[model samples]
Target chain A: MIRYVIRRLLLAIPTLLAMLTMVFVLVRLVPGDAAVSMLGDQASEQALDALRARLGLDQPIHVQYLTFLGDMLRGDFGTSMSSGRSVLSEVWQVLPYTLELTAAAMVIGVLFGLPLGTFAALYRNRWPDYTTRLLSLTGLSFPGFVSGILMLLAFAVWLRWLPVMSSASSDPLTHMRNLALPALNLGLIMTAYITRVTRSSMLNVLGEDFIRTARAKGVRPGPLVMRHALRNALIPIVTVVGLYFGTLIGNSVLTEIVFTRPGLGKLILGALQSRDYTLLQGLMVIFAAFVILVNLLTDLIYAAVDPRVSYAK
Target chain B: MTPVLDIKGLTTEFRVKNGWHAAVRGIDLSVNANETLAVVGESGSGKSVTALSTLRLLPQTGARISRGEVGFGGRDLTKLSEREMSRIRGNDIAMIFQEPMTSLNPTMTVGDQIAEGLLIHRGMSRTEAAKEARRLLDEVRVPDPARRVNDYPHQFSGGMRQRAMIAIALACRPKLLLADEPTTALDVTVQAQVLSLLDDLKRDRGMAIVFITHNLGVVAQIADRVAVMYAGEIVETATCDTLFADPVHPYTEALLKAMPRVDRKAESLEPIPGSVPSISARPAGCVYAPRCNYVQPSCAAHPSLVPVGGNHEARCPVRADKGEAA
Candidate 1:
């Protein structure tokens, strides 16, 4: 298992490098000059030239790419053009919020979706099954931002149950309250995905002969479903959850924007708008790293859930 | 001696696109202590359904026991509540299914699978159950039982998995074991080994067994008595020796004729001419009438079972009349 993890981590190097190259090129391709954006429209040509040279933006694209790669290798993401702060420090500041949102969404999704899906499968063709299917279908059809807005309106504006936006408070309880609507909005969307995958996977597992064998062995309904059916059913559900978790990390952009929360999505959006090349590139690499990390965690979870599945194997 | 299991007029139905269709017609069968009663038939002849019905393990949503009384240990199993039935299942009455490759839970260790029944019914502590599980594995003759107990199902071979399944079924020392074609998934050598293992276990424990199978050869090897099912009903039933020597029903005769014998070098093995009728599309008259060579105009009505002497019975009017005339 150690060897397997080490191999995976080693393999991620090339993948991250590729991701970093693509982000570097793509951010540069955006129709604006970073130096011009930094100095604003009133800046003289000579001033723009000086700023460009100072930021090393005047160098050839290949040379700049090499410098970026070298710095990244040396564990340095250059300072943000707008804030004059290290890109890493800026990412670190907002990293927790994004992690918190994704984690909350994931927890909510699994807690509700897993059982709902299991219930749907167990009582297939019944009212509960139909209700879950319909609910998930509705959830799937709505975009995350739209749902976030709807939740904001319903809970914060209308019901006054939750705060309208995330507050700049350090208190965990108050912070949680502020994040509730956005987290729930994203969570509901994730729940839909989890429910659909869980139901189908559960249906497949429940139909398996092992489940019948378990039943024949006089395994009661609760343990039989959970230990026998659900355990086997979890592989596909885990795959879906893991893939969605990676998506949740990057896809929180719209939800964060709608909720006006200070997170990676908002951070990256700011970088993109201000043509903060260093920060944008750094955040993209971080996102890539996160996706790779999530995939690794998912694989580990698979091994945990099923004894037959092994990273070494 | 009183039977361990007495199933009377058991009818099972599956809801189809149109309506409920009976998969197992009202059939009476019983298994006495320490005896192996083999319910033999071709596929779709309700043999598996009969076994499933006995345990009330039929698919809950689409299939159901429409009418029946499964009397086991002086209690009506059909009349038992879900909770009561659960208590009986895997405790007093255990079942092992066909498809050894898939019967055991893939994610679980074979030991835990075997120990599950012990834990639930025997109320054994986890450590005790684990030890018993190892012992059960050893009894089933799985090599390195102590180490293999921690191994998942995928690690075990098909035959070993089947043995583990048997260990699970026998873990609680159930009085009756329902084996639904348990050896069908295995090759001939493994099949023989499993059959003998089951026979030995039955002998040692004196437990009744209702072995459901499609293979006549398996029935001949392990069965004390035989019940031949066709089209959702038992067409003939007799002591194993008697049934093999003189199969009275035409379906039974056809089935016996279809067997490939090594002693005779025949051009080709004979197969029964027609397939078993579909449950939903069953004929009004005798189920085998459409396929029987001796089908007659008088064979238009379904015939009830008739005594053919010495604990043998057949559900065929023409055969019964011919026997009487002779």
Candidate 2:
């Protein structure tokens, strides 16, 4: 298992490099001049040229690309053009917020999705099943931003229970309060995908011979579904959850925007608007690493849940 | 003596496109303590359904025991609430199914699967149950019981896994063990070993067994009494010896004739001419009339199981009279 993990980690290097290279090229390809965007279009040509030279934008594409690769290899993601803070440190500060959002959303998804799916499979074609299916369908159909906005309007504008805009408060309760709306916005979307995956996977496992053995062993309905059926159904559910975890990282952008919260999403957005090549590339690297990490975790969880899956090979 | 399990007029049905169709129709059988009753049948004969119905383990939606009284321990199991029935299942009445490869949970260790019933019904502590599970593994003759107990089902061979399944069913020491073709999926040598193991377990535990299978050779070896089922109905039931010697029903005789033997040429084996009738398309009168060689004009009506001779019953009017006349 250790060897397998090491191999997977080794294989990710090329993937990370490719993503970094792509971000390096693609950010430059966008139709905007980084120096002009930073120094306003009305700035003097000489001043813009000086800013471009300072930002390393005046160099040829290949030279800049090679320099970026060299700096990345040395663990230096240059300072953000707008903030003048180290890109790595800036991303590090906001990474936790995105992680918090994804983790909270995932907790909500599993908490609600597993029970709802098990209930649907058990009742199968009855009202509970139909209701859950309908709820999941509605949840899936609504876009993350639209739901995020609806929630903002409902809780902040009308109810006045929450603030219209979020702030980086130090108080735990206030921080939690600030996090709730955006977390819930992404959480509901995740719940939809998880519920759908869990329901179908559970339906398949419930028909297996082992399920019959469980029943014949006189296992109670509750444990039968949760332990015998759901445990077997977990591989697919975990796959969906891990895939969505990576998605939630990217998806937090809209929720962050709706709530005006500070996070990696906001950081990346600012970098894009101001054409901060260093910060954008750094954020892409983080995103790629997260995707690889989640995939690896998903495979490990598969081995944990299923005994037949041997990583020894 | 009161039988450990008495199933009367048990009719299990499955939902077809039109409506409910009787897969097992008006079946009555009983197993006394320490007796092995083999219900032999071809595929689709509703043998497995009968076992599932007795435990109320049939699928919740598509299938149900439409009519029946499963009498056990002075209680009508069919009338008991699901909550009450669950107490009896795996405690007083346990079951092991065919397809041992898939019957055990892949995610659970062999010991945990066996210990589950002990924990659930016996109220044994986890450690105590673990100990008992190890003992069960030993009882089933699984090698290195201490180590093998922790291995998952996939690690065990087909015979070994079936032994584990038996250990799981026998964990709670149920009075009635419904083994649905327990040996059907094993090798011929493994089949004999499993059969004798079951026979020995039955003797040691004095638990009644309702063994469902298509193999008469297995029945002759392990069954105390045999019921020949054709198209969801018992065509003949007799002592294992009588069943092999003077089978009264045409279906029973045909089934015996089809058995392959070392003494007979492979060409001499006669496959039963036609298949068992589908539940939905069963003939109104006799279920096996179309497939019976001794089928008579009077076979247009269903025949109830009637005594043919001492300790023997056959469900064919023509054959019953012929046996008596002889």
Candidate 3:
């Protein structure tokens, strides 16, 4: 298993290289020069020339690309043109906020979604099932920003239960209070998807012969559903959760903007506005790395949950 | 001696677009201690339904035992609460299903499945159940059971998986085992092996079996008595030898002729002329009358199961007259 994981990590090298190349090319290809955007439009031509030289824009394109790759290989992501801070350091500063938001959203998704799904499946075609289906449908229909903004209005402005802006407070309670609204905004969407997947998977598993076998063995309803049915249904559930984790990462950008949280999403948006090419490219690399890592984790989890998933090959 | 199980007026129904339809209608069956009663029929003949109804294992949606009294251990199982029924299920009565490939839980170890019954019904400690699970595996003749006990169902061959299922059913050492075509999904050679294993286990344990299958050959091997079912009703019941020697129902006669046998030529194999009637569209008269070879004017009226001779009964008025004349 360890060897398999190592091999998978090794195979990701080409993918990472490709993603980096795309970020490098695409960031440069966008309209506006990084130096021009960093300085005011009224700046003198000589001042612009000096800034371009300092920014390496005056160098040959191939030379600049090689320099960019070399610096990346040596763990230097260049300086943000707007803030003049190292791009890697800036990314590190905001990484935790993004990680915590996504993680919290996932936790909430699993916590509520699994039970709601199981409840729906168990009481299938009944009122409870219908009610949950309707609730999940509503959750699915709303986009992250719409929900995030609405929650901000309802909880922060209307109710005054939460802060309008996410505060970088030292108090743990204040920190969590700041996280609650945005996390839920993304989490509710995750829940809706998870609930649907789990319900269908559970419905399918409940009909299996093994469930009948367990019943014939006098396994009570609780363990029969939890142990027998849920364990068998877990492959699809875990897959959906893992797949949606990537989607949540993407959705977190909109959610962070609405919640006014200082995160990778906010940093990347700032970099994009100022045409901070190096900073934007660095963030893209991290996002691509996250996608690769999540896929690996999903595969590893499949092996853990299902004994039939052999890693020997 | 009192019988182990006596089922009467067992009618199971399934909901369809039009209305509820009887799948297994008013069938009577009994199994004595130390005996095997094979419920033999073609697909959709309700043989499997009878077994499921007895255990109350039918799906809650779309299917129900509309009326029946499953009398086991001096109590009507049909009337028992779900909790009470569960106590009897794997404790006093156990069941193994068809499809060995899908019958056992794939995610769990074979040993865990066997040990589950031991843990729940037998109240054995975890360690004790684990040890006993290995013993049960050995009993079923799973090789290297000490190591293989930890293996999952997918790791085992189809035959081995069925054996593991048997090991689980026998874990609680119940008085009855409802084996619903337990060998159907296996190869012919594996089928023979599982048959012998079940027979040996039945004899040693003195447990009565309700073996549900369509294979007459399997009936001959495992059954002391056989009940022939057609269109959700028992058309005939007799001792295994008697049923094969002198089948009183036309349906039973055709079934025997249809079976492929080593002594019979390949070309001589007869297929029953038409399929069993659909549950919803069944005729009010004798259920098998349309497909039956011995169609008489009297067959328009539903025939009751009546005794023809000693321990032999058939549900055909016309054939019952023939038996009397002979």
Candidate 4:
């Protein structure tokens, strides 16, 4: 297992390099000039030239790319053009919020979605099954941002039950309270995918001969569903959940924007608007690393859940 | 002796795309203590369904026991609530299925699968159940029971897995073991080994067995009584000696002739002409009429089971009277 993990990490290096190159080139290709965007329209030509030279923006694109790579190898992501703060520090500040949101969403999704899916599969063609299907369909159809806004309106704007926007609070309880609406919004959307995957996987496992054998052994309904059917069903469900975790990390941008919660999504948006190229490139690399990490975790989870799966093979 | 299991007028149905189709028509059968009753038939003849219905383990969504009384240990299984039925399922009555490869839970260790029933029905503590699981594996003749108990189903070969499955079924020492084509997936050698194992276990434990299978060869080896099912009903039943000596029903006769023999240098094997009728499309009257060579015009009405001699019954009027096919 250790050797396998080492091999996986080694394999991730080339992927990370590729992502770095792509993000470096892609962010530069966007229409606005970083120097011009930062300095604003009122700056003189000479002033703009000085600012560009100072920021090393006047260098050739290839030279700049080489410098970026070298500096990254030395663990240096240059200072943000607008804030004059290290891009790493800025990312470090908001990293917890994104992690919190993603983790909360995952917990909520699995907590509700798994039982709903199992219920649907057990009562297939019955009213409960139909209700879950309809609920998931609605969740799938609505975008996360829209739902986030609607939730904000109902809970914060109209009902005065929760805070409208997330605050950078020190207290854990306050942070959770602030996180409720956005987390739930993202969670509900995740629940839809989770429910669908779990339902289909469960349906397949429920028909398996082992399930029948378990039932024939007079295993009660609780242990039969959880120990026999659900565990077997988890392989496919885990795949979906892992893939969606990566997606949630990247796609929580819209939900973050709607809820005005400080996260990588907000950080990236600020970088884009002010043309903080260094900060954007750094965040992109972090995001790519997160996705890779999530994939690794997913593979490990598969081995844990299924005894038939062996990393040595 | 009072039979361990007695079924009277058992009828099971599956709700298909068209409508409700009776898979197991009204049938009566019984299994006594310390005996093996083999219910033999071709596929779709409801042999497996009959076994499933007896345990009330039919699929919950589409299949159901429409009519029946499964009397076991002085209680009607069909009328029992789910909670009550559950108590009898693994404790008093256990089952093993056809596919040994898929019959055990893939995610669980074979030991845990066996120990689960002991834990549930026997009320054994985790450590006690674990010890019993290892003992059961040893009883089933699995090598290195202590080590192999921790191994998952995939690690075991087909024969070993079937042995482990038998260990699980016999974990609670149930009085009745419902083995539904348990050896069908095994090769000839392994099949013989498993059959003999079951036979030995039955004799040792005095457990009644309802062996559901499609092979008459298997029946000849392990069965004390034989029930030949066709369509969705038992067409003939008798003591194994009597049925093999003189099969009264044409379907039973045809089945025996269809068996490949090693004793005689026959020109070729006589394969049964047609397939078993579909559940949804069964003909009125006798279900085996189309396949029977002696299918007379008078065979239009379904024949109720009749006694031909001591402990022998057949569902064909013509054969019951003449004692032979014309």
Residue A7 lDDT, candidate 4, scale 0-100: 92
Expressed as tens digits, the lDDT of each residue in B1-326 for candidate 3 is 98999999999999989599999999889999999999999999999899989889999889988897999999999999899988988889999999888989999999999999888988999999999999999999999999999999999999999999999999999999999999999999999999999999999999999999999999999899999999999999999999999988999999999999999898998888889999999999998888877798988899999999889999998889776564
Per-candidate Cα lDDT values, in order, are 0.89, 0.89, 0.91, 0.90
Pairs that collide, model 4 = none
Interface RMSD of each: 1.0, 0.7, 0.6, 0.7
Worst ten in a row by lDDT for model 4 chain A = A244-253
In CAPRI terms, where does candidate 4 land? high
True-structure lDDT of candidate 2: 0.89
Candidate whose DockQ is highest: 3
Q: Which predicted model would earn the best lDDT?
A: 3
Judge candidate 4 at residue B212 and give its lDDT. Answer: 94
Error of 2 at A41 (Å): 2.7
Question: After best superposition, candidate 4 residue B44: deviation in angstroms?
Answer: 0.7
Question: lDDT, candidate 1, residue B19?
Answer: 97
Task: Encode model 4's per-residue lDDT on B1-326: one tens digit a residue.
Answer: 89999999999999989599999999999999999999999999999999998888987778989998899999889999999989988889999999999899999999999999999998999999999999999998999999999999999999999999999999999999999999999989999999999999999999999999989999999999999999899989999999999899998998888888898556566778989989889999888888888888889998899988888999999789766431
Between candidates 2 and 3, the lDDT winner? 3
